[model samples]
Target: MTDFESTDRPYAAFPVRIGLQVQPQHAQYADIRRTVAAAEEIGVDVAFNWDHFYPLSGEPEGLHFECWTMLAAWAEATERIEFGALVTCNSYRNPDLLADMARTVDHISDGRLIFGIGSGWFEKDYDEYGYEFGTAGGRLDALGEALPRIERRWARLNPRPTRDIPVLIGGGGEKKTLKLVAQHANIWHGFGDAETIAHKHAVLDEHCRTIGRDPGEIERSAGVGNKSPEDIGKSMLDVGTRLFTVSSSGPDYDLGLLRDWVAWRDEVNGE
Candidate 1:
């Protein structure tokens, strides 16, 4: 078995992707676009934005925009950078329709879309949007049902995704969520330090084994919060994780951490 908790694996090996989640609350479209441009110019691998109606941090009534629409605009604005929501609320749209929208965005980005999705959580997004924010279990149930519908829709949608758009599921719920990740997600993003991540990863491995899926086929990812990549840099790379994302909340959209993380990725990857 490959050890994913040490930073000595050729140090300069494996595919490394550095991502930034641009918090779209309290920012103008111009600033958001500039942030995207800066991230691309600075060599960030993937630039993302969250899908929310109300700001998660700061003033709840602050500025926030819809996700897929911003993504489509990002697709048209930037070149050479992958784009998607950090995670889209699954309850907001029909799975088939979501898949089709992703397909369209894929073409717009010349195949740079990552279909990052999750079961809808924030109650405001559900309530105000007229979506029923069901129980967490029910929501996971919805997500599980949505994934296959999306894939099927992609296969059936005329013109298809410009590329085989990857599905990224973010959640750490071991029982149902990780199981779904094992079965369907191309990338899995979770919130955990090394030990928790290792435990969850092991559980996911077991899930993969049970379902006859290859664990190696899924790329592990995590959000970089509070800690600078400079501090936890090697630890992240050690854990079989190739995708690193740092989230920036708006009003500032500060990217100092993200820039540092990107540098760390480049160094670790020998770029």
Candidate 2:
């Protein structure tokens, strides 16, 4: 099937959700905190920070903060916005420990948590942190193994998660990534233009069909980085995408772009 081929599938049952990933780099904690607070005030549904030790762009050694800790802070700070890492690196922490942390954060947020995770990438994060920089396939294999452990730990935790913490898995690797999405993810995040997203959507659908899971059960999320939110969001919506994420970085975690996207989402959902 071509990229543009429609699956004749129904739109996702949920209303459109707008997410803002405020990169925890080149900024102070207070600044990041303000950004998230502003985002929630402006009607952003989800607030995200990526898991990494160093900056991913701009100055490499620029100021940066840790992921889960910041997520915990975000949990305490925001009352309405659901929060998590855009995609937590599965290789960074032991799976069981991660589950417990997630549970704690769930309580902190009073049940507003989305446990977004993915196979580890970024050799720099691995090498500098003394983690083995293995091949991509190896990392994915490790992730596949860890996901089950995380779930099992969640089940066994004392005062279990306040809710079934939604897992949002990122990436568009057709074979392994999409397979894991079908098996595990409640929300699947992919980055690309409309055509690329449509193609991956088709691949994800196939994976779901193979696993006897309905594709509509997993929400599709797209990253709209500094793009025309209205134009691109409309395209994404046409192809069954309901979550649109816009990422802004620190020093000054501006939400002007995000505000536009939030407005677009309100229009789409008639909120």
Candidate 3:
């Protein structure tokens, strides 16, 4: 067995944070806006919108809004919850330009922006928007190239980001993706079951060691489905995962599950 199998790396001690991703599809912008406000009032730590041109579910041509613009609106609309795209597609915008947009939103939200980004998938999004739509490997390669440029651009922005602006990289590719998570990500948004997450954490640990960075420096995040939030969340938390996000799509954007998770978070955080 590898070092990941060893029990030496204790669970990273940190306050649990719960986030809600209000999917920006099949709903009027008014509904989406209202949902965000409610999520903040309910005491979620973060609010997120996915970056996509069209709806990912329900009617193909449904009421949908652009990602960054809605985020700008969210920055002004809500007070407490930090917000951003769950995972903005790097291929959609130039890296430097994306960094600038993030900085602008950061200031607007009074430093309440989390820069969550990932390599673009969803061929439909690429085809409809006239992008290249290359292989997954190609997209990952492009993302690897873009991250540094994005950071460089952040360094040069006139009004620097209100804070370092946590970089959340989403994806579970073990080889390249996990390596990038080790090198750059402040938070790593992941997927899969407790076993899957444990394995990913182990792989991430190996990469972190290779890069001479502490694995604890990058917070572990995962998406929570409706299956059994309490059971699954506890198992994940045992493995050092701290930030749990429950994603719901519109037209309703029901956050009942998210609220439960938030309560669960408080219980675990010892509040």
Candidate 4:
């Protein structure tokens, strides 16, 4: 759906949508499913899985998983947590087909899906998948074209998204990427500590203003480790970051940090 109506009032509190980007690179599907179910049951706001082939941090050729199929399963299994790929590569699928798949999963999840995506990166995925590993600019150009087609296809899909499917784009590229987020993303996810994230947030705002769109129309999010959630959370929150994420992975994916962040979310919400 339309991201939001442009507004002039002071922006509201960023919703505490905790994201757990469960890496599938080193984990079995059943094990990963268990981890996802547990997190949903534990009151996580968002449950995410990375769209990757090899383990990002562990064994390079470990037991890995594809993104869309796993997300389809996640949609059916979890009833609570909003689920999606942490960011799907724009090059991997035709944008219209991707939109249709997202719509189908939206129905399957009864509208708990977030259409998270990004311009393709990771040369390995491109090489292995046979997608052109072109320049970064070319990939972002693909994304720019794909997003509108995705939106258009969404309108023509037989069954509309059960709920407005939120488009979540993750990146920190200042030029085309941030501008795309301003134009299309309902949520822009960034990976950085407080200072880096704050800088990106301002850049995103400038992009929005340049396009005549209000920056706060999109939710600004960042992913950080749980080691300093308190300080990071307070710091990012001070600078307009509402969505904070801690990524987890493995055969026995732990939800300990996730629970702690949930408590932190309550404390902040209480304040």
Per-candidate TM equals 0.94, 0.96, 0.95, 0.93
Q: How high is the CA lDDT of each candidate model?
A: 0.84, 0.88, 0.87, 0.82
Kindly list the per-residue Cα lDDT of model 2 for residues 1-271, writing each as its tens digit.
Answer: 2232235754456578899999999999999999988898898999999999999999999999999999988888999889899889998999999999999999999999999999978889998999997999999999999999999999999999999999999999998999999999999999988889889989999999998999888989988877976568667777878888988998977778888888877776666
- For model 1, state the Cα shift of residue 25 in Å: 0.3
Ranked by TM-score from best down, the candidates are 2, 3, 1, 4
User: Between prediction 2 and prediction 4, which has the larger TM-score?
Assistant: 2
Best by TM-score: 2
Q: Tens-digit lDDT track for model 1 on 47-76?
A: 889888888988889888888899999999
TM-score: the better of candidates 1 and 3: 3
Off by over 4 Å in 1: 1-14
Where does candidate 4 have its weakest 10-residue lDDT segment?
1-10
Alpha-carbon RMSD, each predicted model: 2.6, 3.1, 3.4, 4.1
lDDT of 4 by residue, 1-271 (tens): 1122112322334566677888886778988998888887877888888777767776777889899999998888888778888899889999999999999999998889999999978898888878898999999999999999999999988877777789999989998889999999889998877679768888888888888987767887788776556567666666667777777878778888888887887776763
Best of the candidates, lDDT: 2
Once superposed on the true structure, which residue ranges of model 3 sit more than 4 Å away at CA?
A: 1-11
Q: Give the Å error, residue 143, model 2.
A: 0.5
Clashing pairs in 1: 4-238, 4-239
Runs of candidate 2 exceeding 4 Å displacement? 1-7
TM-score of 4: 0.93
